[model samples]
Target: MEGGSSTSGGRSWSIYGRAEITARYEILGSVGSGTYSDVYRARRLSDGLAVALKEVHDYQSSVREIEALQALHGSPNVVDLIEYFWQEDEDAVLVLEFLQTDLETVIREGKRRDGGIEVGEVKQWMVQILRGVDACHRRGIMHRDLKPSNLLIGADGVLKLADFGQSRILNEFEQIPTNEEWMPQPPTIDQGVSHPSVGGYENQAAQEQRPFNQEDYLQQLVDFKTRYGTNDADKESNLQDGDASCLATCSTGDMEDDPYKGSYSFVAEESAEHESGTLTSYVGTRWFRAPELLFGSVSYGLEIDLWSLGCIFAELLSLKPLFPGTSDIDQLGKIISVLGDLTEESCPGCSKLPDYNKISFNKVENPIGLIACLPNRSPSEVNLVKRLVCYDPASRATTMELLLDTYFTEEEPLPTPLSELKVPSTKTTHDGGSLGEFYNYGNMESDSDLEEFGPMDISTTERGFSIRFS
Candidate 1:
């Protein structure tokens, strides 16, 4: 959106389709910074409303976050994007709803409590998280980076999902077009030939045309992938011939060759040339990263988010991280040490992951299960985590399923009322005057924290700061 000249005297600044940012809102102070963006707390001049000004430096990240927010406009559990500003030469600025604290702070707050967060409170947070995740997954969007720091809490004690810069629209048909005016129109088809169905050709004139149901289509694809796993040799051929729309609308990674290769492939095959079409494996915080991602699997799906959800739940139950690894290799080692050996029997088609053969570890004779990770937790609570934190991506529980599980379904420890839930303030400091790691927007870590990790691009860099739980 373009803007006119501002009321200010000197330089004519156009911002947010009206006056300059300084004219519209009073900048309070800087809150957070990341590789691609800087966040500042601001107050709208007209309404005196508190909002976050996220000045995005990276062009691609700006577009991604904007698109994702636009697509998820009315989701109650997702963060609200109030407005944005983008000009020819200057950087893009997003005006978001201001949130006081995050889930990380809530978990820390719970630690100080007599017995940690109550069961009902934990269930409430999980319910909100699942609702947000289910909204994204149902719409064919992958948050890619789901962690405690990224989930924010407002004054009303409601949790909202945030930090969408790393999000992606997986379905090609559902992709939002940048400029519809510039988009090429599809060619007209002949009237005689009928569109091909999953199995055979159909006579369009003879049959009643059914309206396209994306939800049903996606569910079928999930059921198909779950049963077939990644070992079906004819999977690609079947998708190509029987249902071309499935590949375009439902497929996640490379179906035939490497199941771990992302759909955004630049290279068709494994060759001497630089690896093409490979998504950056290092996208999330090390503590909650999925094993497939740790093993450099690019062609992942919503399952990665489920794994992170499991980690978050475990922390809520125990008031500590389930696996706090020092590095990527150590992260995998920690998971292996708990879940036993990573094998084909444990996770079918796991060997197909790009880095499965590269990373090796000694098999644990007696692996400590999720129960050990969450001591004193009830069987239902532990079972809830086990449903998601597993070796197989397909085996991981979907948000819908988790919401229906006995842990959430049972009436005893019900989700806490919103008024009963505690909400921490962002201004709250710990360890004297130091600010907590997760009390700001954009969910970024300082450059000094990642200096030893080597240079990386905005998309590939480690996003969240790690809190090593001894």
Candidate 2:
């Protein structure tokens, strides 16, 4: 996609082409695509300001995310969406405020190269994440997906929650409606005893029944084969493959007819709608999958987000994912190993989840002892992790509880804002040209670059103040 100029209402503005935006963002040089959406580093042509751009192919998903983000503006801890553009023939482009790094990068770097993050720093990071999440919840929104990669660190060292794509906005009555048309319905079936020679009512049934579309069935079978890589013949003969669990659950009576069954669907229907309000879908990096989702809970809400946060926090502390299973069953086992077994008493609502009856439970072994796994963590740090990782949604701590925890209060002051932090100047060759012994010229070049790369001529004071990187 390329960014270009466009007119909205009566005002004219330059919009970078989708392709141009991707190139300008310069992310191609840093990391391979890590998300379903294509990401890039982009520069605003009007003022030459740098920002990140994400191009979404699905129009519905794009609009949903944009609406959610617009509601979150003015939040200190939330990542800001600078601008968005859509055209009939092109993918939606979301221009976002650029950030220096994400928590995932920081964790990996600290673990492999610089040892682990200091205990105080971990507490500070958690405090920032909780504050951001709290702000969202206060505004009647649930992040739904709270992973390390989604937490972005700005150039000013401020942590902001990005990716509202999976976020859900609650109304004043604290309810969200589900789209009924997307719900899956149970398949009708006929059952009867049969004998070898008794071809009873075959012709009569053919005359009374509507003709089934073989092509449509074939297409569905093809899609299933492509997704699961299972042979159609094998599926026809016996549907016992582990990979077929999701399909089996959906096909059988185990799953609900309503798609939004596990979501927050009880919100009153007559409540006033915000300028924009809608429930988002399940979206998160693979490793952060919540047990409720994996087990096929239909109407789950913020509890899923808390699960992801726990996983992220654990990874941050141990430098390894707490549950790194490859499949749903494996993922559940990983979680069970850490949290102990899930019994009827421990997980009261387990039977309500789809496919719950299919799997049997055994005494779960704690593979990695909490403190031993996070060898670098202190006692307080361990306590915080336990609170966040609680299996029961009601038992999990709220954002406020986390922020007020002793970890953040007792930690040393956070690092100075990146905007105020000075960058040391060092002599270097520029395009094979020597600039040494030319102090006056170097100073002039620096000023010129600053002016050219500064904020747009339009005042952003109304929106927010810019952080000056010295």
Best by TM-score: 1
Task: Provide the overall lDDT of each model, using Cα atoms, as 2-decimal numbers.
Answer: 0.63, 0.51
- The local distance difference test score of model 2 is 0.51
Off by over 4 Å in 1: 1-19, 173-278, 427-470
User: Tens digit of lDDT per residue, candidate 2, span 200-301?
Assistant: 111121233444454553454344324322112232211121221221222112224433234321222211222233332233444566665555444444
Instruction: Give the TM-score of each candidate.
Output: 0.71, 0.60
Error of 2 at 192 (Å): 58
lDDT of 1 by residue, 324-420 (tens): 8654445666898899988999987777655465435556899998889888989888998999899988788888778767678776779999999
The RMSD of every model to the true structure, in order and in angstroms, is 12.8, 24.4
Error of 1 at 395 (Å): 0.2
